[model samples]
Target: MATGQDTLWEKFIQPLFGFLIDREALKELSDSIDWETESDRLKNPDLIYPEYYKSQNFHGIKGGYLNSSAAVTYDPITKHALPPNENWNREAVIKAVTGNPLKIIDLGCGTGSTTIMLKQAFPNAEVVGLDLSPQMLVMAEYKTQLERLNVQWLHGLAEATSFDDSEFDLVTASLLFHETPTAISQAVLKEGFRLLKPGGQVIILDGHQKTLRNTTWLTDIFEEPYIEEYAKGSVDAWLGKAGFTQVLTEDVWWTNQLSTGVKSISNL
Candidate 1:
């Protein structure tokens, strides 16, 4: 079933998001950034700043604007289609954490796609979407209004979420890990663990750098400046050290993977 989903994602969704949407947005966003100069600095021995670890506003504006445009252009059909199969994984995460309904938090939820999807899947559960970009939050809010989904949108950082501890039944992130620094990534994981209720689950859908195997050439070709390093990062180890149990990591696509961990019920 997962394999069939992956095939559909690659054959259909990937092209739609990557070529139809992401490529143009990424190109414009990259051009707006000083990638060449930053690339040079990254090659320097003393330059410790990671090349891709930037929190600039242009990324927010460009991404938010493009996503908003995409949202508006796609209208009802496109708006409904944004979640992709990752939403299916989110449903599985909800089932894994609690047999019935569960409150879910979507960290780094861009444009509120995952957040709305969660609401659709579990209408009874409270859903919160947190992001660092205010512009993105606006776009998310717009989408939520269009769908009439009752979701709370918050402008917050993943590394230092404002929510109280043990507040959520499940915490989820999709396509977010690879864009953050190692330190920030660890901090986000810790925050996720802190936010979950006892027996709550943390489900992350992101790239699986370790699973590239035979597609090294294509992987490298398609991967951006930070892809290689992000792929090599030890997210599973970070989650384990953060006091999560039942840590599970699995390959999903040419680059995508799903990693999850559970907060023990005793700790809740």
Candidate 2:
């Protein structure tokens, strides 16, 4: 599915890792998985991918999340990318939760890393991790299987999910906004607002806008097409526009930020 276009990951990091790690072992590991069959089981055949998602290469991968290669390689690159530590970065999302949420959903949940953490933190909650990429969902399912975690991995769009309105007690998105266009990001926030029940909270973990704005190199280091725009915008303002109350945005580590908002209890 690669378009033969070189990305920063492909041009630099991948080659560096290949030099240091066992490429044959990695390839053998990739080949060992039944990618097609596994992915097909999680795929929503009726879902149509948007032009915004399909047109661009992500993380130097030609087909972006749609490709099996992206799912295979995401965790390795992510471990190096997240500052402090990947687990610490993701744990911030779990720590942001307020009350005991019975129903939770993670939008754009890549490979179920953070999603798994959510389940671990709130074991009694019903956790659902949804992503547009079936390949990514396959990896997520595999991970949950390993942990014996009761989590649902769905192939669906973040901006528009199939679930009923006001269903979830909590909604979370980690490192998802920067990869999407600003408008789409806004729409996703609105969708999160719609999905949450009255008095429910929505948590977003992504790049620190101010840090990214001040440091051009951070955005430049990755092949993220929309990060520059994401850095320029305000998630606080977006949450306000989406009809959320008690909104707050706080810095996490040096490069990331966590934004949270609650739906009004009076909505009922």
Give me the candidate number with maximum lDDT. Answer: 2
Looking at model 2, residue 176 earns an lDDT score of 96
Candidate 2 off by > 4 Å: 1-11, 19-25
Displacement of the residue 70 alpha carbon in candidate 2, Å: 0.5
Candidate 1, position 16, lDDT: 58
For residues 81-117, what per-residue lDDT tens digits would candidate 1 score against the true structure?
A: 3245545544554444445446789998876776787
**Candidate 1 minimal-lDDT segment of 10 residues:** 55-64
> What lDDT, from 0 to 1, does candidate 2 have?
0.88
Report residue 149 deviation for candidate 2 (angstroms).
Answer: 1.1
Worst 10 residues of 2 by lDDT: 1-10
Question: What's the CA RMSD of model 2 in angstroms?
Answer: 2.5
Clashing pairs in 2: none
> Each model's TM-score, in the order given?
0.67, 0.94
